[model samples]
Target chain A: GESVGLHLPTLSVQEGDNSIINCAYSNSASDYFIWYKQESGKGPQFIIDIRSNMDKRQGQRVTVLLNKTVKHLSLQIAATQPGDSAVYFCAERFNNAGNMLTFGGGTRLMVKP
Target chain B: GAGVSQSPSNKVTEKGKDVELRCDPISGHTALYWYRQRLGQGLEFLIYFQGNSAPDKSGLPSDRFSAERTGESVSTLTIQRTQQEDSAVYLCASSNRVGGNQPQHFGDGTRLSIL
Candidate 1:
């Protein structure tokens, strides 16, 4: 079945360093993608999103890069902080459908102070 | 000024008992969604509602699960004869009518524990 997946289940980084998390999706028809940060005991919080029309989008200190050719997406966080430590998930949405998201297994980000 | 709100942040029940979860979406948002997340997994789409259109329930795992949304406001998810496998965090989100292109605002989910 078509699905979205992440390359790593866990990523450890030192404070002040850059963090990059990768995802691979198999749905070619998906036109929208989003990155969400979920802290413990909380819901998934929207971080950034990108549409098929654009290859990259940036927000605050986060950037989302999309590669349709490779069916890949990446989220980059600059100067990682303890607050940034959480489970990050990448989700894809097929335009043909009425705004439904297919989510990928999360990547847990751990920042060492 | 408020975000989505959910009732009873945590629920614990024995097998065979039924449970109902509630969600209050952002005011004026017309799209609402329900998702389930098990331990160490991703969000599993359960159902979605957009305005007065028929809800898409294809993601529902079984007939035991059901949900209802009144107009564009509060929504409820009911699970009947709950089993241990039903233990998970139930999440609810809502977005502006613009669809997936717009980020969905999520509420802190309800944690369900079935023993």
Candidate 2:
């Protein structure tokens, strides 16, 4: 029964403020975690990913933090902008499961200009 | 230069009708995946294909759903006698390999609606 879940359904923030989205996963053996952003009428786009070996990974404007003990993962976005408003999803891939990804209920990030 | 591509951006069909959705993975990619996204939901894994190996169809919901891939390139997902519950966006993704860490690039997806 592997599952990934988010702490919030919606996150609202000011245009220039920082944003943090939280996720909780039940599978301890999952070795890979990724965050994706989906805009209206578009597919999920890969934003950042973190491996079990590392606690954190940073992308251009995003960072993913992984905490194995509590089975928690978080995505932090700096300088949130209107273009950054979208639904964000966290996914996990168990090392033994090939390339199958289990996605979590998405968190919608709303940036108010 | 191109990413994954799915055909018929939109499809509306009556209940019980059959539909075929196509996917064109990136060139030279050996892994392909099919996922379903319902309204206001996350992506649901459906099936996966890697190279010449038998596909992993464990995620397929029912016998009515089946898929076929020619080599490692194009793939087609067919739904026979579709039901209203089957209405969802069918997404196709591909990665260079089947490794756990490899990222999968997705297509825009084909929106399926059952009337």
Candidate 3:
């Protein structure tokens, strides 16, 4: 089994404030990374992604940053809202042979109003 | 455009029973994958299908677990002799291709409980 754990650190932000969730991956061969959001009773939904060739990618209200040097990935959400409350996951894909994604432990974001 | 869909949203069976979870990937998706997530845990890759190559069953917990995908469409994950530890949300995802920047689209997942 592949094990990719999170940083075990969470960020709590007030409503309307920006939030940043971080992740650490172990495999340096990982060539692709993605951010997913999972709400209660649902599977993970794609939020944004970054290829190993690039460092940053942004969406409507979300952004993903990858630092290859440190094998670190981060997701930033602007003006975080209650709807943003959920667990965030960062997955890494190493090599293209199988191209399977190994996911991180996940971070629970709490947006307090 | 329809997203990936899964079947039977929920299932409950006694220990030692067998259960099958299904996934219908988005049309035109050539790659499908199966994963499991225990309560409060992250996703665990189970298998991968690219066009027709051998399915990657490396992450499958044991021989009791197997999956099959017909053509480039629906996929089924079977768990035999279910145990209490088998209770979890079985997730399915599909991608446009095997490599590059394509994101894997996921279904809501099938929640399975072994009583």
Candidate topping DockQ: 3
Candidate 1 chain A weakest lDDT stretch, 10 residues: A1-10
Q: Rank the candidates by DockQ, best first.
A: 3, 1, 2
- Superposed by TM-score, candidate 1 places the C-alpha of residue B48 at a distance from the truth, in angstroms, of 0.5
Proportion of true contacts reproduced by candidate 2:
0.60
Write model 1 residue lDDT over B45-91, tens digit each, in one string: 99999999999999999999999999999999999999999998899
CA displacement after TM-score superposition, residue A53 of candidate 2 (Å)? 0.4
- Model 3 stretches astray by more than 4 angstroms: A1-10
- How many clashes in each structure? 0, 0, 0
Model 2, B12-111: lDDT tens per residue? 9999999999999999999999999888889999999999999999999999999999999999999999999999889999999998588888998998
* Candidate 3 residue-wise lDDT, A1-113, digit = tens: 21122333466799999998999998998888989988777778889888888989889999888899999998999999999988888999887655689998898887898
Tens digits of per-residue lDDT for model 1 on A17-90? 99999999879899999999988888889999999989999999999999999999999999999999888999
Docking class of 3: medium
Q: Which pairs clash in model 3?
A: none
* Per-residue lDDT of candidate 2, residues A15-36 (tens digit): 9999999999879999999999
**TM per prediction:** 0.95, 0.96, 0.93
Scored against the true structure, residue A28 in model 2 reaches a CA lDDT of 97
Global lDDT of each candidate: 0.91, 0.91, 0.87
The number of the candidate with the highest TM-score is 2
